[model samples]
Structures are given as C-alpha cells and as structure tokens.
Target: MLKRLLPVSLLVSLTALGLAQPGGLTQTLLPYTLQLNPEQFEQQGLALAQEAAQLAQFDQIELALPRAQLAVQLAPQSAKVWSLLGSLYLQKNDLDQGITALQKARLLDPKSASVLFALGSAYFQKAKYTQAVDYLQAGLKLKPNIPGALFDLGNAYYMQKRFQEAIAQYEKAIKQDANFWPAINNIGLIHYEQGEIDAAIRQWRTAISLDAKAAEPQLALAVALYTKGDREQGLALGEAALKLDSRYADLKFLKENLWGERLLKDTKRFIATPRIQASLVRTPQPLLPRTAP
Candidate 1:
C-alpha cells in the first residue's frame, strides 16, 4: 500500500486592512491576491490525487477524473499523481489516455511495479498483447507476489495463445492467493479451449466453491454442464448466472473474457435456450463495470 495524502483546503489571501477612498469613506473591500508556493501546489495536487483514489474506491470514477487530471497538471513530476490519473482513465474506459498517463508515470518512476502493471492493463485493453506481456512481466519481476499482476500477465499470454505459459502464471497467482478465483476460472477457460472439458469443469467448480457469487465461473460451469447433457441443471445455473450479471449473456463479452471458440459455441447454445433468454430480459442489470484482467 502507498502512503495516504489528505485533501488540501488552503488559500493565502493578502490582508485587506483599512484602506479608505478619496472621500475618507471606508471601501467595501480591496481586490484579493492569492498565490501558492511550490510546496503548496504539490500538496494540493497530492490532495486531489487522494480524493480521486477515494472516489475510485467507491466506483465514482466519473467524478474522480477531473480531479486526477488537475492533479497531474499541478504535480506533473509526481509519479503517484500521474498513476492515479492513468487508473482513473482506465476506469473510464479511456485506454489511450490511460496509457499516456501511465507511460509518463513510468518515465517518472521506472521501478514502480504498480505503474507498470497499469500500463500492461492499458495495453491489454488496446489489444496489444505483446506490449501487455512485456509490461506485466516487467511488473511481476519488480514485485513478484502481486497476484493481480500475475493474472494480468497470464491474460496477455493467453491472448497470444501461449497456453502453457498462461496456465503457469495463473497457477502461480493461485499459489500466491489461494482464494483468487479469477485465476482458477481462467485456467478453466484454457482447459476448455484445449478440449479438456472435465478438467475445465473441475476448475470452474473449484472457483465457484471459492466464490459462489462470481458470475464467470458460474456461467462457464453452466455452459459446460449444458453441453455435457445436464440440461436442467445447466439451464438453471445459466439463468442464475445471468440474473447476477447479464453482460455474460453476450458472446462478444465472452470473447472479451478470452473464451475460445469451442467454449463459445457451447455458451452460444446455452444462452440461446428460452430459459436463459427470458432470464436476461428480466435480469435488471445495471451498467457494466470495469472487468478484471
């Protein structure tokens, strides 16, 4: 974790004492002069950056963005502020802007693993698998135990069809954080793509056991079961999965999650069932959040 900075609410205004008009009548006021020293500006920027991070934690990124943007302007040399701006942009789905800010942060602090990880995520969002892999691997080398960065590295490898390496990274992530269900769920994805349905099902089952509310594994398990002739259970689970998050109902979204063709074909059929379709219609889904790497 990084050091915390609180928001600043400081202004130094020149004193307006008794200056009278030519008629000796008291003037309402004199023009105010405000100025901030270098340290003051830096503190203000750190303050705004802190506010942005707090808002992002609450998923209030739309309101956090401008503060982060101004933070960077006020403290352009501060790697942390630039990184915060980049993360805010990423949350807003602004990959190019995020990448730019992350790149600047990297230049400011080349050894920052978090900034490198952020750059990797931005590149991944832009579909630049090689760049994503480079950045993620670099970040992992700097901070080896970051499970999220390891999972992100695995995703980059998966995108490049480097399945063995991807699974190795995923396995490493699971080792680092035993309850990291996303890594386990992703291993299932790779197994399914490699035609090992049983293995994939086991992995998804384990992931679901770890976090029953996770929609990805639930949906994957549903599709696999459906294709394996467990129609009733599959349909029921699929409906439940969609009710949890309807975006999984879209093939395009599945593809974005790195679902390969074989699993996708099965998922297409699973979601096409009248039951899942009806569930999607009445799911009451809200806006999509930033998906995990």
Candidate 2:
C-alpha cells in the first residue's frame, strides 16, 4: 500500500513579531523588497508554494522542485514554505532530503501541527515507523484534535502491521472529524485483511457515505467481495473503478486478477460497453446486502 501523506494547508498565521512595521521595515528590507509590503511578500511566497504543489500533483517534478525551492528562499523561516518543499521532495522519492526540510520546518515552529505531521509523514515514507509514531504523538499532544496527525499515526501503525493500534488511531481521527473518509477506508482495509468481511464491508460503506467519490473504499469493497466468492458483483465494482479512473494501474491489475480469462479475451468488448461505463457514475442506490439470499 502506498503510504498516505498528510495534506499541507498553506495557511500560515504570521505573528505580529514576524511582520515589519512601515518604519521598521526599511532596515530589515532585502534587495528584493523594494516595492513589496511585508505582508505582500509573505503572500507571494505562499502563492509560489501553492503553485509548486499543484505542479507536483501533475507530475511536473522538475518544475515543482525549483519553484518550491525558490519559495523557501523567499520565506526562509516560513514553516509553510519548508513543509511544501518537504512534500515535493517526498513526492520525488528523496526521503532524506524531505526529512531534512521537515526537520528545519519543525525547528522554526516546534509546536506547529502541520510541521510535526509532515515530519512524521517523511519518517513513515522512509520506513522509520518508530520515529513517525513519536512525531505524530508529539503533534497530537500539541493539537489534540488534529485529524491529519491521527490519520498519519494510524498509517504508521498500519505499516508495522499493528492492526489494533492502527484502528485506534483511525478511530481517533474519525472522532475528531466524522467525515474523514480516508481513515474509514483504511479501517475497512484492515478489517478485510483480518478476514472480517462483514466489518470491512460496513466500514467501506460508511466511507462511501462520507465521500462517494473516494475510489479507495470502492476498490477495497470490491476486493473483499471477490475474495469471499461474490465474483460477479466484485467484477462489476472493479470495472466501475476503472471507469472512474481509467488510468489507475491498480484497478487494471485487479480486473485482470479477478477475471483472468475474461479480461484477456474481451478487453475491447469490455471497454465499449455502456453498463461498464455507467457503473462509474454516482448511483442513487447504496450497496447493501439483500435480505433473502
């Protein structure tokens, strides 16, 4: 499973101490500050970080890395800037560099919930589950109800196969934000792996209720159902997932695995069918078991 990284919100709440008043701004001004207000400069730095993040999402890694580095340069002490740069590095699979950036951000603001979460996530990505747990626990201490911290802490535990601990963290995350679908979906995956099909299905259904567009829950439900001998229904859901995300490599592999001979023989036939395509659309009915088997 690809480790889920916490989303970094770039809303930096700058303290009054960080702001330079009009007269006081002059002495602290850098060469690049000739025409910009202190606030405007900070805002620009944040905007650049956001832009870099969007580019990174599109897999324009080369463009994102340099743009984010420039944003960090523009706001050297900004935790948001360093966090954004750290995320970009993680996306590029440079765990060591990512950890360094996140550590720097944490040093700048030791109690920042976002920075601590990012640090924990970097450690998790590097397979340092113990360090990830520590950072996440510290973050939760500072911001006891932070949903992301709880969610990532659950992820760290899950990676270590500590199912009970992972579920506890995910439950805490859901308690903080009942609409947190990722945690719900993750719980479903854990249940499925433990052979508790009914519980897994329930969690997945709850996740879909919270966020119908989340493909993970749907895919997980499909897998559990197929493994439990509901092959046809499972195949339908798997096909629906592919329709929703035609480029999702995992869905394609799952389809092939579930319907080995059929997938091999009727690839074009399957793709051209309307029923297959319509399955991706949001349906009015909920996926539940029939009363009479």
Best by TM-score: 1
The runs of at least 3 residues in candidate 2 whose Cα sits more than 4 Å from the true structure, single-residue gaps closed, are: 1-64, 67-80, 246-293
The total number of steric clashes, by the backbone 3 Å criterion, in model 2 comes to 0
List the lowest-lDDT window of 10 residues for candidate 1. 11-20
TM-score for each predicted model, relative to the true structure = 0.84, 0.63
Question: lDDT at 263 for candidate 2?
Answer: 26
Which pairs clash in model 1? Answer: none
Off by over 4 Å in 1: 1-36, 287-293
**lDDT tens digits, residue span 3-117, model 2:** 2221112212122224223343346643212333556656767877889989988889889897687678557779878988988898777999998998888889888887787
CA lDDT of 242 in candidate 1?
Answer: 81
The TM-score that candidate 2 achieves is: 0.63
lDDT of each: 0.84, 0.69
